[model samples]
Target chain A: MIETSHLSFTIGDSQILRDVSLSILPGVVTGLIGPNGAGKSTLLHCLAGLTEPSSGHVRIDGQDPFTARDDDRARMVAFLQQSPTTVSRLRVEELVAFGRWPHHRGRPGPEDAEQVAKALDAFDLEELAGRPIETLSGGQKQRAFVAMTYAQDTPWILLDEPLNALDPRHARNLMARLATLANEEGRSIAVVLHDINAAARWADQIVAMKDGQVLAHGASRDVLTSDTLYACFDTPFDTVPHAGRKLVVAT
Target chain B: MRPWVGIGLVLIVMILASLAVGAASISDGDGGWLIWVSRFPRTAAALLAGAGLALAGVVIQNVVQNRLVEPTLTGTPEAAMLGLLGVTLIAPGLAVAGKMLIAAGCALLGMVGFLALARRISPRDPMLLPIVGLIYGGILGAIATYVAWQTDLMQFLGIWQLGEFSAVMQGRYEWLWAVAALAFGLYLIADRITILGLGETQARSLGLGYEQTRAIGLVIVSVLTAIVLVTVGAFPFVGLVAPNLASRWQGDNLRANLPIIALGGAMLVLGADIIGRLIVYPYEIPAATLVAILGAGVFLWLLHAAPRRA
Candidate 1:
């Protein structure tokens, strides 16, 4: 479990994240939804221990992630930033293999290769394994990055705007894969998503934010209500049930 | 692999030709002692300097996350020159080693400054970093030039500015051997260096001490540049050309590509030196001038070549 207590982040004179406390449970897909500049990405970075909170603390499995050793933090949380830069001429398989770095630290063992191969297969990247990441299409590159994060084999996986470049098909496929990983492999995933309908349909829980503070956090059905959506986005949103899942639409 | 074999053969021919063609022909009866004293040392100096600069280029590129920028373009050589000028004026009696230590320290400081500036700019325009570096180097070079002129050390400055192997002798160039040890150390951490090219967040998330690794890389680059500047002066373009060619032929897997990059650097510099020897036949031009001419051409070609893969 990942928990934050009165977390706040400030940069110079501006407050990016206000005092916010939340819990991310294991074995579930939690979606973070907010408008632009709502501190969704900053919050995600804080949880990944990539950014330090100004006045509060975050704990992952009872250990402070901000203060943990690098290897220990990496073993517990894997983070995929939005639009992660690619190293030129780095092959897809090699990129995925880097996910095992915390485990091997440069020297790879048989288990590392096995995990890398499994990640490639999981993301359907086998055909593009030997290709350079720069040569892949946007969707393919996104898949390669997702596979790299998956190969980290961490208990908590955090992604910021991973679906930005993905097409609808690839986006749905990725959400399904994350759901399966959460359900079967028991990984806790917190993904910052721009697409509210996708979050409503796939996310086990939803956290709504606006102006650096959480407005609502609960089961998808409870948090996806039109009133909460309006309070979070300052825009009217209609939520309807479709095939036993809530579908959110701008109205 | 076959192409590499071909390149190896070409390099061997060039080395032999460089050893044979000099002010004094190796066909002379006294050629054995002359080759041992001057020709071999000169060749070794050129090779080591080339390999070191090329390796330094790769590390700097990865650390800065910019392919177009190298130490030569990034004010490193000029900063080292300034340090050398300072030591020359303050402690003219200092040994070459002392001078090198001071120069390396200054170069490290300059690189850190460049990196700090680089952090503020976006890497979206690949050409921007090199341009910034060129201007930075120019300002430093102007300061060094003013100091040299004021101190009446312009003659020494000229020699440092135009890197050449003509002055290298058995005892004069042994300090460059430090580059070999530095390169070996870099190889041991090649994987970490490659990981660094992934940028800050990913590298940190992968458990790398990103700032620490960048500092170590800068130190290596500074030391390498200092050694070369102290020994052969500044040879522009070898660092940029060698690593760029190697990356095009192979990939960015540092461990797998470093040897090839080193060899390519050695060959290019040695080839330039040989051409300098034979082009005028005993009235030799400086190898540094020849490399600048060739390196500039290649650098231009690289700029106009196909769009970058990244």
Candidate 2:
């Protein structure tokens, strides 16, 4: 379980996240949705222990993420920032294998290798395992990063705007993969997304925020209603049933 | 066999040629004695300086995560020269080891200042960091020039500015052996250095102490540059060319490629020195000038050739 209580983050003179309080259950995808500059990314960073909140608490699985050792924190949560990259020509397998570092430190045993192979297979990256990551297309690169995160074997996975450059087909495939990871492997995922429909189709729950505060928090069906989205985005939105789920549209 | 083995054999051949191709006459009867005293040390100095500067370049490039920037471009050599100038004026009687220690300290300071400026730069523009470093280095070089002129140590400054191996002797060039130890130490932690090229957030996410690793890399670069400067003046482009060429062949699995980069550097500098000796015969050119011209060509080629992200 991931929980934040009265979490507030202030940078210099501006307050980025204010008095945010929420709990995320394991084994489900939680979509963090808001308009631009709505503190969604900042809240995700605080939850991942990458940034400290000014005057509140963040706890993952009953432990303080900020105070835990790096080894312990990495084991508990795997956080992938937006489009993280390296200059060196690391092959896909090598990059994914580094996810096992916190576990084996440096020396790799059979189980670690097994997990790496499995991650590559899971992401369908076996064909590209030997290729340099820089040579891959953007969607392929994003999939490689996701494969790396999955190889971490952490209970909680946090991602920030991972679908930005991906086309719709790649986006759907990636989201479906995350949902499978949540449902089958029992990983808790929190993804910051700009597209409301992607979140509506794949996310089990939604955390809506506006101007640095949570506007609504519930199941996707309840939190993604037309009224709630308008309140969150300050724009009119219409919800219509499509393919057994609602598609959010601008009006 | 690995490609570097072939490169290594060629390097050995070049070392032999450098041993045979000095200004000494073939009729000089004591060739063996000259080998023990002059030729051996001079050849060794070229190889060691080349390896050290090249290794220093790899370290800084990884630390800053930019291939275009290296120790010489990043105010390191100029900063070491400034420290040497300071010691020459204040304590002219100091030992070479003592001068090297002070020079290392000043080089570290200069690198720190350049890193601070680099932080404000957006990494999207790969050209910016090295350009900033060039300007930073130029400013420090100007300061060193002014100091040397004021103290009438311009002659010493000139020698340090343009490196050559004509004066290396057994006793004079032993200081560069520290680089071998430094390179060995770097190899032991090559994995950590490789992680540095991943930028801050990813490195930290992988449970690396990012700042600490960068600190260690910068210190090694400074010490390595200072040692080379104190021993054989300065060599340009040794750092930039060798590692890059090595990478183009073998990927950046740094642990596996560290030796290749070092050897490539060793061969390049030794070859340059030999060419310098033969260019004008008994009236030899400085290896630094030759490398500067060659390195500038490679630099331009790197900038415009295919425009891959460095």
- C-alpha lDDT score of every prediction, in listed order: 0.90, 0.89
Per-residue alpha-carbon lDDT of candidate 1 for residues B1-310, written as tens digits (9 for 90 to 100): 6987898788888778878888787788999999999999999898999999999998998888877878988999999999999999999999999999999999998888888778877788878888999999999999999999988999989988999988899999999999889989999999899989988999888888888998899999999999999998989988889988888778778878889888888888888888898889878889889999999998998888735633
lDDT of 1 at B115: 82
Q: Relative to the unseen true structure, what is the C-alpha lDDT of residue B273 in candidate 2, on a scale of 0 to 100?
A: 90
Q: What class would a CAPRI assessor give candidate 2's docking?
A: medium
Q: DockQ, per-model, please?
A: 0.71, 0.70
Per-residue lDDT over A10-82 for candidate 2, one digit per residue giving the tens place of the 0 to 100 score: 9899988989999988889999999998999999988888788998999999999889887788888888888
lDDT of 2 by residue, B1-310 (tens): 7765787688889988988998885348998888889999999999999999999999999998899888888999999999999999999999999999999999999999999999999988889889999999999999999999998999999999888888899899998999999999999878888878877776776777778889999999999999999888988888998888787777788888899899988888888899999989988888888888888898888788523567
Q: Which pairs clash inside model 1? A: none
Q: Highest DockQ among the candidates is held by which one?
A: 1
